[model samples]
Target: MAHYFVGDIQGCFAELQKLLLKVDFNPSKDTLWAVGDLVARGPDSLATLRFFQSLGDTGKVVLGNHDMHLLALHGKLKRNKPSDNLTPLLNAPDIESLISWLRLQPLMRELPEHNVIMTHAGVPPQWSLETLRQESQLVSQALQQADYLDALISKMYSDTAERWEPNAIGINRLRFCINALTRMRYLFVDGHLDFDCKQPPENCTNPQLRPWFDFASPLRESHTLVFGHWAALMGKVNSPKLKALDTGCCWGEYLTLWHLESDQKITQKRLKKS
Candidate 1:
């Protein structure tokens, strides 16, 4: 069985299908790992969510910022934006089931055999593997609980909580966890999260800001870290241990599919509309 890891889909379903076809992906024999942002921006969010939901055990996905935003909208905590292109997904007859499935997906996935770990954005430099697992589970568990889900989703929208505090409790802790796992891109020299910069490393003019992956982490020594979300990275990183998979498919670039064992990259460009 082969393991193929894909970048942020962002509802580009047709392109995803083309990539799968290129790789000759057999769902029965291969497992597909998605770095998240499964819905939004591109067309056909409904179909993309449905296809992943139908994959059952063969598909693995982590939650992205867009996915969390969809949850907030579903809960009436946030308004839908036209740019998100999620109207069809929200209006789908199976929307409840789709959202429920999405909520259960973890913020982090670890493949111990391959010594690989994945999150939507890069893991925080301050967190150890155990801390990462525990913190991720906290949000996932809260999201699965009907009583706490709405309140949790409501409080997850802030960027105020930047630094990680071991003793932090309540909503602040949850917000930090969500931001770090899903929305993080750059960090200040003082080791605080910077949410403002979305440019690629080379183009970033801020001297104080560094891409999150630039910081040294013990986790990188033992395992390869795969992530998506910063589409501007365009599948480039300074270190081999850090894999940036989002190639901006939804932005008219291409989708990337990485074969885990052989380290082969297969890409499919966005199809132009007729």
Candidate 2:
């Protein structure tokens, strides 16, 4: 009945299996909390999607940037990047089912008992817990609505605003929500997203930019935050309340699986080099 939280799998099926074996995970009992990026940039996107989709209630996944991109490119093979390795998945017979399931996945997961919120990237510093939940539901509803899903995914890639405004509406608001929850990493001192800085905090030459968690904000400090977008950090950051899980499994680094209750890490090496 142990809960295992795994980092960006990026379609590393073999490594995922190895990590599950190392942890002795049981589908019928144990729960798997995936920190997103479930598909893309690896050898077996189709197999990975199928496995997770088959998990049903046993597995929970938050949509990562890659997952969203996959949905956006559905029925349009020419738009997908070759490096993403999404062709096999797009060609699968059950591709529609997989895409539908992924669309239904939420952008954030709140673990009430653990007092933690898990997202693909860090939560926005400005959002309160209630606001976060409300925003997530709004976006989730838009994605699940077949009539509005394509339009929402098509406009989600924009990050031009740099900061979120409560008054923002329509595509701008959806883009803001998508960026903060899926692609956020660094932030300006004024709490605006800084998309230019992908380097770790120590490597950043600009004092104006700080890791999202390092910003002096109440939402970040009040509860535990588990995120996985910054592989360059290698799960190292200067915050007791934050846990980074992405170890660059897609970049030929180790796949990390952290046990929430005991803070134990289980790792497996990548089979292919990036």
Reference-based lDDT, each prediction: 0.92, 0.86
Give the CA lDDT, 0 to 100, for residue 156 in model 1.
80
Question: What would the TM-score be for candidate 2 when compared with the true structure?
Answer: 0.96
Q: Quote each prediction's TM-score.
A: 0.98, 0.96
Please, what are the lDDT tens digits per residue for candidate 1 over residues 75-193? 87888998999988898899999988998999999999999999999899888999999999999888888865556987787879999989999888988999999999999998889
Worst 10 residues of 1 by lDDT: 146-155
Q: Which candidate is the best by lDDT?
A: 1
- Number of the predicted model whose TM-score against the real structure is largest: 1
Model 2 Cα lDDT, one tens digit per residue, 13-55 = 8999999998889999988998899999989888888999899
RMSD of 2: 1.7
Please list the Cα RMSD from the true structure of every candidate, rounded to 1 decimal place. Answer: 0.9, 1.7
lDDT of 1 at 87: 86
| Residue ranges of candidate 1 with Cα displaced over 4 Å | none
